[model samples]
Target chain A: MTDKDFTFTIDGASVTAQPGQTIMEAADAAGIYIPRLCDHEGLRHQGSCRVCTVKAAGRSVAACTQPAAPGLVVESETPHIQAMRKSLVEMLFHEGNHICPVCEASGNCELQAMAYRLGMVEPTKLPYLEPTRPVDASHPGIALDTNRCISCGRCIRASEDVDHKGVFGYCGRGIHRRITVNGEDLAHTDAAVSDHAISGGVCPVGCIIVKRVGFRLPIGARAFDRQIIGEAIEEKRR
Target chain B: MTAPRKARVATVSLAGCFGCHMALLDIDLRLVELLKHVEFDRSPLNDLKHFTQRCDIGIIEGGCCNEENVHVLQDFRRNCDVLIALGQCAITGGLPAMRNAIMHSDDPLRECLEEAYVLSPYVENATHVIPNDPALPLLLDKVYPCSAVVKIDHQIPGCAPSGDIIYETLVQLLAGKFEGFDPHIVHFD
Candidate 1:
């Protein structure tokens, strides 16, 4: 809206951004969704999941962390970029024990929704890791299933920034990387069901679940059942 | 002129619950129309236990959790020109693959068998015997998706992909369209 704002083109459409705004922020404002996993609204962006990888001025960059520059052209939905995003999503599926049929977050999970959006009917390319992760149900009102965690750091951010509990953090590295509680398990920490990190949908996927209220909604009525992810943002263009 | 030879289709439920086959039956009246174009070769719909000849399409409805499932899937891959992994089990190992997470210890299969036959609270096995019948298929260490055991040309992803999805996939595959289902039509659950 001003002369000082940076302007860029994403998939050939012009997008305007403020000086410090990232490519994701600009494209989002312009109603273009660069497929993302780790980056959530209001939370600090961690460019961990490369699902939001985009070709910016001929180089692949994480759109959520990369600052939009004047005259920069970014390609988000090209066949090659889309394939990359699909592969990333597939890797996430293969790395985790994401048995969707029995999963508590089958329909409402952003990871599952992103997989559907990426046209991943089956994750055949990568061998399933099938790692045995801990499931902490000790919390009186919450449950933590680490098998579905993508290590996006959203819960860590939300707990630290929003709830100010500093309850969640990461331990280990590479494939062994996992979310750890401040103390022993979730119950040992200051985590409560009413905490913003738990109630605010910070943990995308079924990693953090509220006890005893799962499967309340039928299959066809859950989030991302009929409406595709990012449809609401894309609707702004209309 | 004689009508074109009907497409020969075979189907099998390996480690699945046969819910997918039920969904296939859920196609309802469309099965009559589908029968006009295709003939069952080894499917349970006709109760044919063995494939007598090469099949045009083989719809597989489960992952390989045991030796029998692997053999059946490999046979399907050999006999059919096209092999489709139908439903979540076949595509991604589904509910059965939940056991794969606990396969870190030695003899994970025996651990699973013991848990089911001896340790489970619902079981009333006073003798604590795990079935070791030689006739029973030997359990694999972990459940594997159909694609891991044999080549899967296409996959339909759902707990039991709706009857409409199964019908459309069959019609499309029969018409020689291999583009696969639209993303919107595909669901994991």
Candidate 2:
């Protein structure tokens, strides 16, 4: 109960977190993986995805934005939370065409990996949306397949926060919400697709892919194919 | 007294590549052991044309892309007590459903037929001819998952779900424990 540090229970395990630290941060520090999409290590807490929703004191809260306090009890591994997460993932899948078999990011995609982590072998009983957003291959180094975007805001946030170039933005709302490039198209934007740009790699799905390297890896040697997304992140923490 | 009856399993491939069946065969030596408790009633393995009797379980290997696929799927549902959709094709429409994106067009199926069969570069001179045989099953406007056509009791997901997944699913089906299938064994290509 110190001023600088406090302990909270997540899934019945006591986890120590620093003052002002969010549950996601503390959980990551404690080697507990919380599924998220819009959240990144360096970005501000947007709390938009809600995939990290957890039960804190019996109320549902987005763990990525919820501050961890002393004696706070958080429930993450419960069937309800997992089902919600699965439904959210399923909603994302239904909203877009996440055909993993032909996707460039099939093995390395976070959305696919998250669905695997949550035990969603088949999509939840939602009918597929099957929206037909065109693929933008205008950028020489990068490609945008709007059909795969889940509206996680990762690229938008990364572009603004890390790249210092607000090249990406979200347009529309609800079912029509989509990622836009400078309110126009990628080719018209000043976004210089570079290897060092965080925007190039921040997308959790195959929506934004760097060209020329689509199928570089062999069938069984891709990122998530070797280790589940959680294990990879957990190993880094260890 | 007579011994207990063996479980009857039927498997079918709709609009999929026969890869899922190959993966099922990948069980290899385990197939012999599995045969002890189950018998194939209408699977490609046994070459049975239709269900002679009611089946305990049915494994569907693809999505519905044409009218015949829908009919076959409905027949499986009617004949089997439990139906398991196997492979990405059966579960998520897989690669065949890529055409589903363009289904809003005027006669998307005809357009696809024209593109692939009539105007394809592989063919010599463009025939500009589309098959319109009455015997052929009419193509659906869009490729649909097995569930879209009929109730799928269970699903095993993968491009061609790995042999391990098929084995585990079979084991679960034989034990009559279908709920809470193991996620570790499920994957997508």
Candidate 3:
């Protein structure tokens, strides 16, 4: 470990993690994987998906949000965590207007991988209430689908705070809600498409869908395949 | 009966359209069945009667619009036993909520007037950018979902809601059966 006396446990196995690190950051440092959707290395802690949630100090909280304390006990992948993540996957399934066949990201999607990871048989908890929504194929390279969004706000916050390419945002009150693509069209046609790299990078969900390149990868082969991200960054300390 | 104990509930909004409210009204016929067990108090529908009965299940729709909506939403948290975000507006901030970016523009009444309504001269004389009605509840600056405002117990999302869900929720509310998502759902995704 890079820092002095930085110690923690994952699944009852004690390990020395970097000092003042998050439980997620510590897990990443040790090459132990935990599924997550709303966390990125340089970006802020979203912890929205709740898939990364762990049992820390005898309670459940987002591993990404819970900062590590010395001798902290963390259960990275317990059956409870698995069940909670599976329920979350079911919620995503029932929520947005996600139609994989028509979606470009069908072959290479994070939600699909999560479903596979969880061995999701069906959404038995909540019934799928598919709301009718229009696709925002308004631009040349990007597509906005409000139906598929879990409202993680990683995209909106990334747009407003990080990229400054604030082309999109969430608006309206409850029930009458949506992720508006700029008060108008967000995908570039005759519009300023903002910085594509920055915009695409910030989205945790595939809400701000890029027209090409992103969705071309083979199934179960995206960057977040199995806690593929965040680990590398935390490992830098080691 | 001795004075009834209070039921703890809250209401919140996320990013979605408030069509959840229209959906909540889908239980209008079933409301007869519901009120037998629990009380329906506090809502936009309570214009004439202000805060009369304490709500057991706080039903909310729409996401947090701005700072004021956040503050007002706490009203539900204060009085209810369990909070239920009643529609898509409560869960994901439905269609109207998608306007978080400057893309959709900030004016909500204008959008409703332009898109959803067949406006006439008699309906409060609304123009392109009509002023907030002093007699009516004010509009928030932006839109949001329910969970953003306060802790939510149950969330029912759709453009509106189903009569069946309200019936089920009422039964559960009366039985004091709370915690977690509702079973007997039709289709989720």
Highest TM-score against the true fold, candidate? 1
Chain B TM per candidate, please? 0.93, 0.92, 0.63
Model 2, residue A200: what's the lDDT? Answer: 52
Q: Candidate 3, overall lDDT? A: 0.60
Cα-based lDDT at residue A173, candidate 1: 90
Candidate 2 lDDT, A1-238, residue by residue in tens:
4678989999998899999999999999888898898887777888988999999999999999999999999999899889899899888888898899999888889899888888887534788878867787887778888889888888888888777888888889887788888945677877776622334567888888887888999878887875676775577446
Q: Provide the clash count, candidate 1.
A: 0
* lDDT tens per residue, model 1, A192-222: 9999899898888999999999999998899
Best by DockQ: 1
Q: Over the stretch A90-181, how does candidate 3's per-residue lDDT look in tens digits?
A: 77766665544344554345675566556553214353455555667777767776666766666656666566666556677665556666
For the second chain of model 2, what is the TM-score against the true structure's chain B?
0.92
- lDDT per residue for candidate 1 within B27-118, as digits (tens), equals 89999999899988998888999999999999999899999999888889889999999999999888888877763555566677789999
Please give the lDDT score at residue A133 for candidate 2: 78
Which order, best to worst by DockQ? 1, 2, 3
Chain A TM-score, candidate 2? 0.93
Clash totals for all candidate models:
0, 0, 86
Rank by lDDT (best first):
1, 2, 3
lDDT by residue for model 3 (B12-69), tens? 3333344555565677777665555554455545442335556667777666765556
Per-residue lDDT for B1-189 in model 2, tens only? 988799999999999999999999888889898989998899888898888999999999989999999999999999999999999999989899988786345566676777777777785544466777799888898999998888888888888788888888898889988665555555788
